[model samples]
Target: MTAPDPAAAAAPSFDIRREVVAVMPHLRAFARFLTGNRERADDLVQDAVVRCLQAAHQFQPGTNFKAWMFTILRNLFYNEGRKNRVKLDPLDEMNAGAHAMPPDQQAGLEFDDFRRAFWHLNEEQREVLILVGASGMSYDEAAAICGVAVGTIKSRVSRARAQLARVMEGGGLGSRTSGNQEMPAEMAAFLAAGTPPKGR
Candidate 1:
């Protein structure tokens, strides 16, 4: 019997490590969205990264690496949330310092406005929007990551947008500046891109 080469056995682990490094910022942002705290989000990202490295061998070829990592982090967040009874509150307090790229001012929907409108949305609606619309993942990719049907993901994004639009149009949300608000689709995507890594 021929002896197995150590380097050959470890090649996939190397690849996984590199991919994880590249995807870390994204994981942090998503974790912050889910956990609603920077410290807790960082911890979740660390745990998820460890889990990914430990399970590297199980990572299949041709799979979407970012999606896979996101799924792991999300599962961790929900699992821990269940154990700790974490309340899913409005995200105004979460990642207060961290922000996505500023969208067009001409669009007439400021990030502050978008963030406020986002607060009015339910958790599930925000979740799908982040996955599909903000994160720039295709509906199929998002559906796979979210473990839902493509149509379901599409419906969530549509409903989330429509509801947000209505929130802008129909005022009376507490602390939000009074006006007839409008959120362009491109603006949503830009604002969803999130800030850079290391708590920036």
Candidate 2:
């Protein structure tokens, strides 16, 4: 057999691989929130990584690699929905963050309230909230990943916050689930903590 050019078979760039490693926690969190199950969420992230590595040549330099990776994972969620649904995991994994929660905090009874109430949010609401509010993505980045207009992304985020707050309030808190209200403290803290690792 003829010798092949080793240069042509060079691996994905060190930068991309580093970013992918940094982004894994966020990707896992996003997948868990979207799929509403832990094991399947891990599976989704694994598949997305494999797909990303296979298509690394298509990655455009000086662009948003985080957004690019998220777009891949999001596409997998939709395109592979049938196979995914058969996993039959309950939306019971609605803590969403699963492992993302700070160790001491998530075990509180308050999060139980947060969990059931969060599960009340429709998937679209949850997705946008996680992307913009939790994952620390820009509005433009979220819109592009969602394949929606910027305005629509804004609307969904606004509504997601409102709905999340409303649901929690209405739940034993006895606050108004009405009017446009943003997510309350625990939600904010959770979202804040949900951001991807920052070391680069």
Candidate 3:
């Protein structure tokens, strides 16, 4: 068999600007989920596009550029998330699981409920939950990103879960099995200690 020319065998180089534009719709969707504001989502997407273009060389052609760009955008949003709280309706859930309700409708309801429950949690708990549950990061990775210990992350996740349960309960979604569900005292103490003092 004849060997193909090294140059001829190579695929054409990918156009960073073109690619970024093509992914704009998807990027906007991601930004909306991240910031919950159309204007801010546009700004964030523009910023991510600029960053992606600036470091175009970092992207390998014929590979998953979209995923790479998304990762950058997601990280940037997380870095600024606390300063800009995502506005979500309590009726719209992000996780509209398998049911008769349309996915979009269900997601909105889920997002809403999640948003309400999420706010009741302290910062550490919220961050851990979002990182692990929404962003899909592992506990260790979340700890590293937050610059904290693994045990600390574990504790935060546990507390966050408990807090979510309580918040949901307070929202009238708690199971009847758990009568008068309340946030455990120990968990409350941990939360109080871990949360940064206001105006700090």
Candidate 4:
């Protein structure tokens, strides 16, 4: 009998690696939302990719690979947090002032204020918001990733929105509409872009 072809034998692993690479942009965006720092986000993505490769055998086929990878990334983030409480630097006011939008750019200012309020939210609140609100995942999916009840994820998203509204209002943005009102246009656009705010 001819010896088995090693490359053919490794094809499954290679396929999984390609899938991981395919979702890297999404992973990087999520990481940026989680870390609020580009450099740290890149490192987090790298670490998550490594963990995924190491645990490749444990990954069941015919599953939601993106969700699986996201779960791994989230767990890795929390694990590292527990081991070494990483501290991110505060947003740079000087940089913000230097890049300040023109006075007529009211929408830009509102978006900037929203970004500031977003970072002020607690990690749990922020995570739920990003997962459901920004990332467009269903509450059920977010709940699974968060290991919480569906209602808990909903509650977190609601509280996060309320808190963000309060923060913006406190910053002289005025009261937002109530009762399932549409989110602010600027906020919606910002979240849709999924990019970290300047000076974060």
lDDT string, candidate 3, 5-73, tens digits: 576536345756568767787677656655655677788898888888778878888866656766677
Q: Candidate 2: misplaced stretches above 4 Å?
A: 1-14, 86-91, 95-109, 172-200
Q: Number of the top candidate by TM-score?
A: 4
Clashing residue pairs, candidate 4? none
> Residue pairs in steric clash, candidate 2?
none
lDDT (0 to 1) per candidate: 0.71, 0.75, 0.63, 0.71
Per-residue CA lDDT of candidate 4, range 51-155, in tens?
Answer: 999999888887777777888889988888457645755364213442267744555555566667677777777788889987768888888888889999988
User: For every candidate structure, what is the RMSD over all alpha carbons to the true structure, in angstroms?
Assistant: 9.5, 9.8, 9.6, 9.0
Model 3: how far residue 96 lies from native, Å: 12
Off by over 4 Å in 1: 1-10, 89-109, 174-200
Q: Of the candidates numbered 1 and 4, which has the greater lDDT value?
A: 4
Residue-level lDDT for 159 in candidate 4: 77
Residue 6 lDDT in candidate 4: 71
